[model samples]
Target: MSGTIHSVSERFDFTGDELAPAYRAAVDAIEAGDLVVMPTDTVYGIAADAFKADAVQRLMDAKGRGRDMPPPVLISVVESLDALATDVPDAGRKLCEEFWPGPLTVICHAQSSLMWDLGETQGTVALRVPDHENTRELLSRTGPLAVSAANTSGKPAALDVYEAEEQLGESVAVYLDGDRVSGGQPSTIVDITGETPRVLRVGALSLDQLRAVAPDLTSDDDPAPDPTDAPEPKPTEDAEPTPTDAAEPKPADAAEPKPADAAEPKPADAEPKPAEDAEPTHEVKPTEEPAEASNKGENNKPDPDVRPAD
Candidate 1:
């Protein structure tokens, strides 16, 4: 029961009641700002107190991840969505209603009032309500946890408790073996922070399945309109008319110095060229490969479609 980091992790079988000693040990470890490996809906995850800055940093460090790849928060219930995130759009709510307690991770703008840090979240947080009952039961007591797949950054996600232990080692204080539940596929991820919901990575849920709930949902595969093809034509049509009209008035208003007024602004107009040159430097959303499952377990298989939350 020591809160200090354990040099050797202890594993316990979490079955039967939620109030078991194993659950208590896991809870105590989390509250003490220590890392705990627990079974999530998709994959076993290393969890830390989401509100604790040092604990969260330990999670990132254990996974060999930097601040850029912030771990997703696992909540106990749907109601906790509003408590962590702000401006949950109607589309986001509908998606959550249809797919929560399952494998759909939604990234929304984080609540500004909250003091916790989940790393370079860029004012947003990825949230999910896992479908596992025991996990949810533990979450009800622990509030929210900053969880990521229980493995090193480049390794495959751990499907069972032993796999988690092998990779995480003593960095974790406690391991709650929920014994690998069904649906091993990673959760499908959708980002609802923008005006429309876009699939960052497809996993347990399909793109078609998401669109059924939010018809406007788009995937990374969908081609973004070529910037070169769009505004250029409209500007061409508008610009041609203006010059023709300017020509007609040139004879009568030649003495008005209108051309001088117009030509004087050319340098100011050229200033935007650098901005136009800089626009293409931006890249699209990061694409994640499906997590490869370990061969040590027969039930564990490599998923080809969706990237894991880790």
Candidate 2:
């Protein structure tokens, strides 16, 4: 069955009155278990009533996906998460608080009481609250819708309704044209079913950004280790001694005297002598001429001879 395309205003009032005709048609189609292609914040999505197993199957068939792969559920408000999931962890609530109505899909334990089968979801379902105004209005009237990227299983996801129509052909019952959707990567997928929340796929929301809300949130690219569970380092026999052990003083009895302690005694005779006398002695002899010495003696010889004779 070829689908009919309806033109929708980009800035229409979402009070369920301005786009009454389009909303009426979309709600009717979804209620009748028919597939509808709609725009989301990240990309265009083909949606169906989440509670209707036949509608979900038809959605999977349109995407050429099998029961092994399940479609994510799109909710109008954050409160819907409580109804859809059981044991919604505090971390999951934190992620919804920070990134919901934007581009993050959280997977958690599905409500056991709900009568719905999304293929091989394994008792868990992925949910998101898109930021698009039109989609939110549609969700308000249609309740939770089982949604997936509007394209074939292997093909690129449609950024606009026309591309979705081209890829899906008549598989979708209604295509609400909301003009060209700002092209961007798909929403990030995070599974909070385990003790440690893990990111299955990275897309619009980054791991670091998600960590801001849930510090324990982990991604396939970077896994964080739990500090409390880290193992304490074991001491090895060859391990170096600690500073306290090495700083300890040795016993005084075992200490040896340093080189400054040994003194040699000096003998009394080894004292230094007077500097003047210490020099070598020399003989003092007058260098007088023989004639001068004889003259001097002859001049005094007469007096000396008279005194000797007396």
Candidate 3:
């Protein structure tokens, strides 16, 4: 089926009497459950009514992709996110506030009540608010649309409407040519199903920019360092000592020595010395000898006197 192509202004003038025919045709085709190729801020995309399961299936068949890879839903306004997603985390809201109307797609838990099937989305939907005025105007009229890159599976994304038309051909009902889009990259996709938001794909929006709004934003390219897998920090000279290190006892050889003068005293009554004999000697015998001698001499003199008298 050879598709019809229409050239339109890059910017939509809502007030002008002359409306863009291409936009009108695209909206009509989407309402009829037909796919339309349009230019987004990032790249060319083929869009369909997200609520139309058959139309979404047809879109997958056209792209030669299976139901496993679901297409992202594109909305005109930020408010449409609430209608499609449920349990919107604070990080998801902040990301929308910072990066909506730009290149950023958020994956969130799908609203259980919504009657729509986006292939094998597994109760989750990826959504984005593109930064193109014409596309936004179309989305405002069409509500939410299931959109994917305008190329077959495994092929490079179509940067221009011509490339999209060349690849998709008659599969798409209407082609709105908004000139060559500076398709630098696609929207960055962040999955908010977990407690921490993780970047499934790195695209136009850098991880740094996303982190500014959601500090916990993570990337598949740069995964968070696991606490268990992290290397134990090596001890440094200036590093603070750990409790185990501080509680260690000192070596036994570091004790102080005792003084030499502090010895014990000896016993008092062990042995006694021999004392001299207590006798006093004198020359008193000379007096007794002199008295004997005097008696003898008197006797001798008396004998001599008797002899003289005779």
Candidate 4:
């Protein structure tokens, strides 16, 4: 609420391609720690300084989100990845090198102390460096912005500045109105949290597209076992066949089933007896005496009870 929603959407339009005032106003808004709705190559995103805890919390509350589900950090450029994430697994780092300035979000271990939360962060963070000018400009002035698709939690992402303004104007303080984002889709999200990088949500990028970078990525149920680690399959051999008319009878001295037999025989000396261990340990007894023991009354009143009955 500290800044105004200045009209810069027209400047961001790719058809018109004018972008001077839009960048300036958006930067000003971000510098003041205000939220901004802006265009990216992917979709319209509402952004706030990634490090400003209060502003970030306000963004989450406004969007009806909790700390457990946080927004992603949008950096101005790819080099910013190291600043926000630690231990960028090789697979994720490789993805960043190829997909940054494009529609792809790399999930990695967030710095232990990052104050902002993206939606359902799960002790991790989504990082992106979009291929858009207005977003880049705003990010440069604002530092990293914890942003998400400019739509309500479960709704479609806004594709243009005007639509974003219509949808998020009340929630965000500024809209860095730029060109209508192409693809009109969210970036592909891959979680590199485990031994293998996995596609949590597929988007603009196809599985084949991701494989070009991380050969280890797989949409298959199981990762292909490492060539060096896999045990070789056992060799199959023919077993000796019995003569058609000859059959082996059960051994008279055998006391247990043979490995290939269907039935197991008991020992000859073993006797069958009642299974005493299986007997019921507890018994129920009626406390009342038989009917013959009770005295008859002429009125036939309800039987005199000795003990209270449930």
Candidate 5:
């Protein structure tokens, strides 16, 4: 019934000690089967008591999400992982030891004995220990809470309380305004229900960082080819140009008639003259140039001296 927003910044000055009143209001709201929007290390989240089925359903309905996409359970301590999840492998344990209380979500087999439903989870539960002190303290008081990003299913997650209010206004019963989240990136989620741990999503924690702890940790997007190491692909038949299309271009039929003109002395299909025939014509022109001087003593007959010169 207490659908009100409390500002931790204005009242508590972000002091962890002064946040008790706001935490109490959130806890009361959850116990009454209502949704509460609170700030986490990553982003603002709308949380409901995991054991309260109606509250969880309201949380899902407010976010426009379905049962197939179940929200994760947030714990105050790492030991709570056993209460919610089972079959925790060594690699999973190592990763939890290294990255717990931060942006890391591990999905494991749910404990069968627990009498609660979180939608169609398929016997698996996603768990996380958020790094924020205020959120963790609230978790310590309220136990495990089914939490999801405060936004419509397809919309961007809210970064602050005001954004959460704008997206999920009346649906949430209590709003804990802790200002904006420091870590903008979502948690890195890993599913350890199988023989090998496979990364379902990459977020704040990188593959390399996870590998440093669990060398065998694998992902569906593993072994990305290094851009520097990848060799440039050789052109194929489809992409490569042929010789005719390359540097040597095909000449047009009428581009230049010089080749045909050079071979034949006349235009069109006329045959070329023999070398001997061309030589006499050139020689007679030179003799005609001295015709005036020779006219006084010589007739139109061949000179006897020219016979040797012929």
Candidate 6:
């Protein structure tokens, strides 16, 4: 929450060109378990030590986020995938091999001892290998970083160093301004929880582009409701009910007439169904209709006059 701004990449300033020192400072803060807001190819992100629970909690609190949505953990490279996630499926590996160091967030099941408390993980976590050089270098020095876009809840994401500084204010220990972002959008998030993969959030990558890299990719297909509102319930139409009169039961006018002849009950024999309603039995023929047609004129019998000489 208290620190300095370091120009760690081209996007921040020309000084970030040799960014190891500033990145080192951010790494030091992370080692001491403090938050660092740094630039990714997409937008500025607030990061904390993945193993530091308290630091992670501060990140969640700072963003005014809930447990349902956990912060994603960014790794330096794809090799770190197995360290934080489980069951690296073919689809997951395929995508990682293809578009990883770009704008793609792969959501997979988390390993049990990941050590950070970002939110209610429900045994799952999101991970990404960022494309930015400063981030890669910082993550190389520091381990996996639990991070999200550096902005207050519900506000637009930070597009530059100043925007991040203005939005994050005192929440993050340091803001590493690299410069203008590589791309102007967030990462394309894909959830690989089920047997089939689902895109949780669509960002820079298109649905077609994602599937081309990983053929098995499918989308969850739910576009979220408008951010401005909790939808109001539709009103129901009111109608009036018609009243009915109560009636009293009347006695029989006279004694009921008796049957002229006594009827004998028949014995049950498959229970006589109404004659018209009985199910009919069908027989199966050896040669089917299609097979008979296929044989056609090939198996025709010889004519009597033609067979006489034989």
Best by lDDT: 1
Give the residue spans of candidate 4 off by over 4 A: 1-18, 113-120, 220-310
Put down candidate 1 lDDT per residue, 146-222, tens digits, no spaces.
99999998999999999998888888999998887566788999999987899999999998889999999889977
lDDT of 2 by residue, 1-310 (tens): 2233334312222334467867887888889888888889898899999999888988888888998999999999998999989888888888898887989999999999989988898899999999898899899999999999999999999987779888987777777877667846999999988767899999998888988888987788774777766664543443323333423432333222222323743233344334444322222122233335444434433322223111
Instruction: Give the count of colliding residue pairs in each prediction.
Output: 0, 0, 0, 11, 0, 5
173, model 6: CA deviation in Å? 1.5
- Whole-model Cα lDDT per candidate? 0.80, 0.77, 0.76, 0.66, 0.78, 0.72
State every prediction's TM-score relative to the real structure: 0.70, 0.67, 0.68, 0.63, 0.69, 0.66
Highest TM-score among the candidates is held by which one?
A: 1
Which of 1 and 4 is the better model by lDDT? 1
**How many clashes does the backbone of model 2 have?**
0
- Using TM-score, rank the candidates from best to worst: 1, 5, 3, 2, 6, 4
Could you tell me the lDDT of residue 244 within candidate 3?
36
Error of 2 at 212 (Å): 1.2
- Which pairs of residues have clashing backbones in candidate 5? none
Higher-ranked by TM-score: 3 or 6? 3
Model 3 ranges with Cα > 4 A deviation: 1-18, 223-310
Better of 1 and 2 by TM-score: 1
lDDT of 6 by residue, 111-224 (tens): 887666777888888999988877887888888989989887899888788887777676666667777686878999998766677898899888999888777777777557
Cα RMSD of predicted structure 6: 21.4
The per-prediction CA RMSD against the true structure, in angstroms, equals 25.5, 27.5, 33.2, 20.0, 18.1, 21.4
The per-residue C-alpha lDDT of model 6 at residue 214 equals: 74
lDDT of 4 by residue, 1-310 (tens): 2333334433233324465666666667667766777778878877776677777776776565677878888888888888778887888788888988888888888888766645566678888888886567667876888887787666677888777766655656556655566678778888876657798778888888898989989664446877667554432232112222112332243232233333655345544334443222223112132222222211233223321222
